[model samples]
Target: MPAEDDFTVTPYAVEGDVDYDRLLEQFGADALTDDQRAAFPDPVHPLVRREVFYAGRDVDAFLDAANAGETHSVVTGRGPSGPMHVGHVFPFYFAKYLQDRTGALVYVPVSDDEKYLLKDESVGAISDHARENLLDILAVGFDPERTRIVVDTADADVVYPLAVTFAKDVTQATVNATYGDPVNVGLSFYPAVQAAHLLLPQLVEGRHPTLVPVAVDQDPHVRVCRDVAAKRRYDVDKPGALLSKFLPSLDGPGKMSSSADAPGILLSDDREAVFEKVRTRAYSGGRSSVEAHRRRGGNPDVDVSYLLLYYFFEESDERVERLAREYREGSLLSGELKEIAAETVADFLEAHQERRASLGPLEAELPKFRLAEAERRNARRRAGFPDDSLAQQ
Candidate 1:
């Protein structure tokens, strides 16, 4: 646990109401400037344009490569400890948006090994979740030729050797300082696996700019990988990062939507389920009485329903502004706002679920997105391993 005034933010645990600005200061990352936002490919993602993604490290190098038509990649990954939720999928969707516009290669890594080592779950249970999570990720509709999905345990032949090479550069003291004391050696060495995920594209495709978009708490992982790249053990550029604010839990601010107890709008949720969760679970900012609310107006800043619409659901800026104005002036009641958010969310989920249902079996669909044989060999060789290391039995 962190001290009273100091908050703890790490890959596993996030406590205290994170002061994002203070975090950037402490971590030495720069805030995403207006100029940097403009540099993103035209028709910027709502996540970026709206400042949901607010800070970054070495983002300029990525934008420069993107605009100049040079090679670049985006690495955003998942830890399949449980079901995939809206919060978990946002970065994948954001990455897809960039891939669609900028033609950037996207690498999606699923870390089942790390989840098993960290969580109480058995390997069997973790593997189940990883398979299910992979299906959801594939439903995001990334271009198969341009996207690669690597599972740490399943792709260990390539992933493990790269992790071993990078692990040599990451000291235990550095890991302790960044991630806290680990209960076991596997947890201790998971950072090396993460470093491999971020650097894999460069290793496979040759040195090029790569950007990792993740929540702010996850920046330390990127920093650790950057430090390893700085050691010049491999011919790779330090991966850049775009850090974002947490999607507020339905209960309210200070709680992340990813919390196990929180009733998140899962990608698998139906329309009725979405409506029920928003109407009942979403925290409101209205006065106690209807008359009081009519007179006092609601605070959209603290309203989870309003935030749902603002964060990703609502695409029209004018409509969002109007809703806020109405809510502030008392024309939009809390229930009405909740209903609007619910409908918007349900509509979005319907489309996503339809696409997911349309997909073929995971065994058949995944091959198109898996790294090719030559790419795997190249990545292993570039990560300082012999050509025959991890050779097939």
Candidate 2:
């Protein structure tokens, strides 16, 4: 899932409480409720607020400034492990919306590294498909020039020497403290590289994206970035982070990944396939029969499929509220609700596929200086600059 990760980047956001009720009020029925908000403890709280979606140390302060029209930038990422899935749409769509509404410079990283570890395949074989894959991502309809998606592995080869130099500066205790296991060295190295990517726009001399928006599981990684940035030994940009939860999969609680490693509800899945999957495989919390449902109501908490629609559809307000009302009143039938939820989810996936097929390449090309600057910024690190490591915020 694009939004869910334990530690793919660095500079962890100091965790804090989020005002979920206000989020639901701000986002209306579209946001998570107070009940769900309480499910996550302290630092996890504010990360999923309605307006901000997710929060961390830099979240509140940056947002305060952003509302005043400050020129801060935000970064979000995508893992190039496989074809983007239905669940992947939420963050991209969300990112597109945030950029359009706020007019902030957005930096998007196509995280090929995570895929290197998560999947059996290498990205090199898919080189030709990179443009095609990104075109599909663009098809989802965010402003073409407002965002940047770097093919991380390609950049990594050029950036790794600096990454290694930075890694050497972090001690085993710091690494072990943040990540409990000492065996996962590769995962540890990824955070630093991601931290470097966070500062890439800044390294070029003019652009500095100060905020990063990602899913909640990824908070650990950003916390590392924040921790390291405080020390200021390197030229790394310490970005504030806003997080969102994994868009629950059709089958379960996390991001929807294809079970057999084939295509999922692609930003390209066809109508027939969409309906078939939604009706047959999507998670359902409704009971077996109408009478049983009337007596017990539908179970929304464990209902994965409905939640899928809840997170994706724009028209969800009335239907979901009504469904919830019926369930609570013991007058709703689970089967019927599931059918509606299936339709809602299927329609969303179908629409995404259409939009994706019609999209174009980036309109405003990235400034050449941006890439060169990132190169030089990394080059400086390779020239024996002291590395500062992440600590808990």
Candidate 3:
């Protein structure tokens, strides 16, 4: 265990007790002020309203464009290194919430290429994971017309050329400083690809306010891309960022993981599996003895079950507040709280699974969400490649 002030949060690793407020200062981001929060589309998402997405960079501009009924966008993506987990789905759901409310264009970028560089997995294995991850993303039910999904390996024709255009402006020193000496040349060059992903909406349509909803640890990626956008090499806005707290791991207060070792609640888990995991593995904040718990109450703040509900599962503020009050007052047992979280999470998963099952073949369903030919052409053209460029051919 690390000392209280010894936490390290980077794109590759997060450890110790994360001081979220301190992170905002270190990353040079602003906390979302109340007025900025109010400016979000009405029926504000619980994630935003409850301050799960606590800090941001240039958030007001994105909200401003969104409010004005302009071409605003939300770029939230996945790196398909493994199975999708509850923690991994938060941003997509949050983006969907904003899209439903404000018609924000959504861009889902799958970084299969980056995952291949970072992980020991074979290309085939990574491709398999990408296919599975894409299904979960598709199951989120983003509007096809308003959403575009880009797979780095699959869409390299466009992604690569755009990345190449940005690569010229990104230096190895910047990549090393941002990501702490990437392991390979591919990793070193990925920031440029990420810049392409961040600027894709602008490169395809036109310069517009784009917001990236991500875990605070991933803010470095946004910062790096912001630097690239600041260079003025391309006609694009510096993508704004909305940073979120890590969802508590099932065992404790750390970022959740879906790797084989840590084993998170997978998107494929059924209701029975969800309940069993919550009952058996969820970290609790109750007293050691029943009598002691009844006398002293519990701490919901550190309880994984309660935090899960507070973070995403339970949507109602009143209900979640009541549950917390009951727990803190000792009227609610940790077991009961786990049960509620299990049921709520299971309900959510079942709905998601139903959507996943109802979808047709990936080939049939994915075409509508993939970038159209003209959009791809425009992106390449805006990235300094002309229509007659060899890359375009």
Candidate 4:
């Protein structure tokens, strides 16, 4: 294990204290320049404007296409190893914001197979989680015409063959070097499936700019896929990446995950539950006593409650800045700050839950968001498979 202060970030786990700048340097991705931030369509998403999504690879190409009203797409995905939480929905919501603004086509691939390979869970359990996760994703209200939700196992007819085409070019050595040695053969071959996911939109729609907005920990997957695209065998552009900081867990200073033991506010969490969790579990950066806190202001920088608000919940730049100012100046009590964050997050969740409740059955709703037969065929053909290769055995 790495030492307490020595951070380790990988697709499978993130540990220790991450230095975002150092991580960017190690990844060889460029920091988001001011010009790049200003180039996003009017009313930029908070994630980009606030520099939470602070680094990227090939961002300018995607932005240029979006600015010129050309076709572009955003690929972000989920691994249904467990229940959906507040942290899981940030990128989906961010994608929706971009789609609404720029009409970016969104591709959401649920990597159930990868989850099963990585976890010790039964296939049935992983499938169950995938079903529940798909519901939460649909609740985000991506335009069905503009979005495609792919389940790896369910869509294996298309996904597997596509993976096979790319898998030929991806060596085991590369996989081990990019990600640590895999425990299973399925895991070893997953980077190819991921490449298929990133390049699928372009494969179907023809070569065009694609942006993948993911947490920085997932950058390696994009890099691997980019290498495949760079091989120039396929008529696809190297997908751009919009890398983000990890959404802090309630206990503070780490990735908020469904797998964590900490009390994460789930998408299904009610207002009361949200309040209780934030009140009791959220890490505080304030002084020990109320008197001490009043005498010496709290540090919102490390406070989970403040982070929740600043990260996504609080939209207004002026308001979030004021909250930080008050916290630093000792006017805002820790409890008061927690309450504010809890209320804001609860309100957002309630709206999400309401939308989720209003949706019909997943079976009825998922078809429109899935790749059509023609699309599947076109993508397969682009991958160098024969036109008749898609025929069943």
Candidate 5:
């Protein structure tokens, strides 16, 4: 969103990794761990959240810290894998609440480098797609001035010198403990890159600050940041953390992989395609028979279609409840739910598409990224600092 007018930006009409329906079949009604649940809110003790995220443990102490702040950074990011999808929407939607209520700063990191590995899109195309995703993020109404957009794949000067040097600061085990196996030596420095990203802005010698909005699944990066911050390695940066839940697919609980053969609401998907996917593929935990469903109330927690509505359709609590009741009574069918998702999703995409297209990449990139400043400041940070924050593609 911060780079809405950038000419370098483009629309990402990307696809999801799996379908909703199959993910539901593969993993059924389940709940999150205590740590994951805690991550639903901002954490206290700056580095504490990351510790919990990396350890896969929960810390009530961290949550208590988040509650004390009047404002905090709301961080969310993307790999620019392609056009956005429902999987991407819900997080930003939730982030809006914090952004509005507290008037907090939000940083949207476009991790197209990570996406390149995950999706195999050509580097040039993925780089372009990453910019498009930023505009879409802006249209969601995030405050541009208060938001910072970092494109890891962008061609820049000072950043390259600092980032590579920073990589050496983080060790292989530390990154591996959280990120798991790296694809190669180049990949091993990911944690350092992540660590620097979390705190780099403070090193800018300006008043601007940072807050991170990482998925609960990506908590490890925060942990690494906290560790580096404590080490006083970066010296100037002090970052806050906000966490969000990843919306499950219509399939059910657990990760709805982009690889599975189920319905996924892709950002690029059109009205008809979305409708068809919803009608036939979106998983609904409704009864096979109307009478049986009516006899027992439906599980809102498990109903994939309703969850989509809860997270994305933007309906009121009462309205959502009414819809749930109808679904339980068998008065509402899967087709009906699918139809709603299709219409709502398409409407959002179509409306945003035009506004985004008008916001060229350079318009967005030139102003928002502060390339000259970031590079200048980065040079200073790396001048005296050790080579501990580098990560290669």
Candidate 6:
């Protein structure tokens, strides 16, 4: 257990049980009020309804724009350090939901450069991961017309220049405070690149509310970008944030596993592999004996299996509630709950794998989602660069 002041949450690390409420106070983000939740489009996403997306910064402004049918965008991104797990793709799906409901533009940035700076991997290795991850992202079925996918290295002509302008506003001390001391200069400057990502939609589409949906641990990155936006160097609002709790890891309640060796249910995992991982590794809150479990009932709140269902897989509110009720009343054993969750997760992955397998070559599928020539020019120009600056060559 972490002491009250001992826990750490950062873009790259999350440790100990996170106190989401305290984090709101600490991060100066507001809890998602009932009114805010209700303001979402009819049939609010389960993530928003369940309070998985529990807190935010400047969310009301984005909601107001969304409600008014004004131009708005969502910036949710990926760092292609390795294979994406279930945790990695949840936000993208949530972003897609918002796009479908509100017609919001979605900007998905793949931060290959950041991965190269932060991980112990070569550029080629990170590029490999980026290509693999791109296929998975494309498989999400975002509208090619409304969604623009930017790979940092591949789109460096635009990404690098905007980051350079934003970098001028951030200081080394701020970076250190937000993300510890940098191991290398590339990382020292990566926050600027991140700020560019958060603000890309505005840069390309002109000033409008942009929302970044991310886990609470990633709030510091948003805050850094917010500060850069506040500098008024760019005609953009501080990108609003929709913060979420860490998804439960298979081993127990903690950050979802991203380590290659960790037992994560990957998007590409087969149905049998998904079941095997969950049945064998999912942490449960049941008692030592069946008799004891039946007598005392299991705790669904701490059970990873129950959490998996609640988080993303089981979408029906009534079904999820019934599962909880049965588990808490001793009618559903922990193993039984685990099986239910495994089935739900497996069903989701099976569909996802099917879509992924059907995709064409990356080179062919990616062009439709890449930024158009005008968008690149506008983004560069908006970031204070001349239209011809680093013009893709």
> Across residues 1-393, which tens digit of lDDT does each residue of candidate 2 receive?
113323232222212223333423322223434643443322332224332354344554445445566665667777665566766656666566556656666666776665565456666744434555665666666564555556666665435654565565566666666655543567667777766656554543343447666665566666666666656665644677656655656665555565573225666666677667666666667777767777777777567656655565534366766767776666766556566765776677666667755554444332321344344544444434323322101
For model 6, the superposed segments whose C-alpha errors exceed 4 Å read 1-4, 388-393
lDDT, candidate 1, at 244: 93
**Local error of candidate 1 at residue 289 (angstroms):** 1.5
Model 1 CA lDDT for position 276:
98
Q: lDDT by residue for model 1 over 157-270, one digit each (tens)?
A: 889888988999999999999888889999899889999999999999999999999998889899999999999878999999999988888988654554567778888999
TM-score per model over all chains: 0.97, 0.73, 0.98, 0.98, 0.71, 0.97
Tens digit of per-residue lDDT, candidate 4, span 26-83 = 8899999999999998898788899999999999999999989999999999999888
Q: After superposition, which runs of candidate 2 have C-alpha atoms over 4 Å from their true positions?
A: 1-55, 125-132, 156-158, 161-165, 180-186, 205-209, 234-237, 261-264, 360-393
Model 6 worst lDDT run, 10 consecutive residues:
1-10
lDDT of 6 by residue, 1-393 (tens): 124656778787787677777788788899999999999988988999999999998899999999999999999999998898999899999999999999999999999988888888899999999999999999998999999999998998889898988999999999998888888999999999999999999999999999999988889989999999999978999999999988899988878986754578888888898889999989998888889888888889999999998988888999989988888888899889988998999888888888989999999999999999889989988988885555655
Tell me which residue pairs clash in candidate 4: none
Better of 1 and 4 by TM-score: 4
Candidate 2 weakest lDDT stretch, 10 residues: 9-18
RMSD of each: 1.4, 8.7, 1.6, 1.5, 9.7, 1.6
lDDT of each: 0.90, 0.56, 0.92, 0.92, 0.55, 0.90
For lDDT, candidate 3 versus 5, the one ahead is 3
What candidate 5 gets wrong by more than 4 Å, as runs, is 1-72, 95-97, 117-121, 155-158, 161-165, 205-210, 236-240, 256-260, 358-379, 382-393
